[model samples]
Target: MRTTLLFAFLLAALSGFAQDNFTITGDGDGFQEGDKIFLSYRSVKGFIEDSVTVHNKSFRFSGSVSGPVRASLYRNQNPKYANVIFDAATVYLEKGNITLHSSDTLRHSANAGTPLNTDYDELRAALRPYFDKLTTLRDPYELSDQEQKDKALVARLKSIYHNQVDLMVPVQFSFVDKHPSSYVSLVTLSELIRDSRWIDKVEGSFSKLSPELKSSVLGESIKQKIQLGKRISVGTLAKDFAQPDVNGKTIRLSDYRGKYVLLDFWASWCGPCRAENPNVLSAYNKYKSKGFTVLSVSIDEKKDKEKWLKAIKEDGMIWTQLSDLKGNDNLPYKIYGITTIPANLLISPDGVVIAKDLKREALHSTLANIFK
Candidate 1:
């Protein structure tokens, strides 16, 4: 009887000892000491709320988290600004300049009954592509031309990384809905927006989610950003420009005010333009008889002037050819936002831009519709 009583006492003491850590008492007394806490108390991981270590008087969570992070107690006094979002799914913890790799064991709270280990595995699997893509390329922002050639493997690996991230969005969001927690949705949605196609589709999708989920983090703030990208696009008027031509003759784009002007932008080094010359020559022949004129503008440097003139002559350019001989100072380019080589603009006689990116058949069809 004595031995049995001793054994029972030891068991009770061990149970009490195990329960003696952090005791939670927040808005909801939902967490206990052994329960793993997700650091992000905000919507979409804005700041991290670290793990709480309990002492005699109060429970304390103190450790360095990388991102905007803080702490909050369970009950009212909430001395710290740490956000404690009350949803039970999976929450991801990440630090700056560090990758939360596949091999690392992620921790979670047992009290909430969260399957965090599995959740963490999925999150890691989803995030792998982003880190992989980043490491593949030497930072292209400051790469030497020769270095780029030497690192072609980087491009291939980077493509794999980007492609993987794209693949993860739908899968990650599916996990969000399956888990049914604010924390899960917050993290999944954030991942979706990072370099996402869904960024373009956020409003339609964001509007459909739980009101708090959308409004708290992915709310009006994200809406404004999307609207900003919608400023103006192509198919707009080519802004007017005036620049000196080959013989130092000044020409304003407005000069051909009442004629069908094919304003062509090309550079001396443009191989596609050289190859397309035959088609352009044919189109010119067919249409020149019927109120058509081509104005070819070159944005070549002065050192390449001879090459420019020779290419024009060799390619049988019968159209009026002009140049500014200042590469980026091609005034028309700045006006119309010509970002690529061999861009073309078509202007009506009354100076309204009717078509852009006009290729062989499309060019013919646009003219046929306009002239007819």
Candidate 2:
């Protein structure tokens, strides 16, 4: 009876161990013995970290995790390779074995294991071809010198890039919508929120997340961004903010309250913002006498004041321009949740945001209609 009881206890112990532990094996061509492979996972409490040593061009990591977690891999001595591994070698660690296969350069990798990892792999698989297509399209070497110098070619490339971006949004948002319970959805939403065009979709996805996911740190942060979104949306009152103009005098958004204001957010370093200045200038020229005025808010830092002023003069943007020289952390950007710029809000005489992100012909069209 004693012998039988001891065997039963050992079997139970083994069963518990199998339920709580995970193992990862990575195989690549260039890793040498004793090289370290680091792993980190995001959890509710924060990131949990672990590492293992490479031996014979391979490495293995084994540990117990409280739950299935998405983790990334990294190694020492090669920051570029580490980025590749981080970007493509993510795996979901659960109570099972995970495997990674990579090339000598770590430029490409594959993961097989838990469901989340499988989902991630599927996403990458679907998007990889599109990315390759974009890379091909963007290859300047493929263009003739004359074609490269053509302004129309630059405009065409920008259009192609924007169209590609439009295609990516639905694919990523579909993943989030279909997998509301998955933490991967949160990651997808985070990426989508970086573009102001997708901010509305991010808000839509937030309502669909599972309770546990909604309570996570990322979820809460996204919630706060949504709140900021509300504050800046069209029809809401544009929040008043003050910053120093190029001449170091204080200017407030409220000071322009009685006039139709083109509240513009831009930076000296922004190529798109610089490109769009002529359209803005044209609108100002056409509409300034008719109660509409452009109040430019620069997100440029104090260190870049010279460049900011130079850009103003070069672009011929003769208007009320203001910046605290605080870059992105400036009051206007913070209050308005302004991420990407060349962004603008058209404010009415009553201080309500009447329109936003008016670009190129749209700015001219809107002003023509408004002042007509």
TM-score attained by model 2: 0.67
User: What would the per-residue lDDT of candidate 1 be over residues 246-328, giving only the tens digit for each residue?
Assistant: 67888887887778888887876887566455556666777887888888888888899999888988888888787778886
Off-target runs (Cα >4 Å) in candidate 2 are 1-24, 28-97, 102-107, 139-150, 254-262, 266-294, 299-320, 326-329, 339-342, 348-352, 358-372
Error of 2 at 234 (Å): 1.7
CA-only RMSD, every prediction: 19.3, 7.8
Error of 1 at 354 (Å): 0.7
- TM-score, per-candidate, Cα-based: 0.40, 0.67
Clashes of 2: 0
- Which candidate number maximizes TM-score? 2
Name the top lDDT candidate: 2
Compute the lDDT of residue 100 as modeled in candidate 1: 21
lDDT (CA) for every model shown? 0.54, 0.78
Residue 98 lDDT (model 2):
79
> How does residue 59 of candidate 2 score in lDDT?
86
Instruction: Put down candidate 2 lDDT per residue, 1-372, tens digits, no spaces.
Output: 999999999998876544458898888876667877778886645677777788888888997765557777777533333423333256777777877777762336677776676677777777787777787677422467687567456556655766665687788888888889887788788767765656777998888999988887678888877776566888889889888887789988898877999989898899879877866887898888999899998889889999999999988889999988888898988888776788888999999999888876668778889877
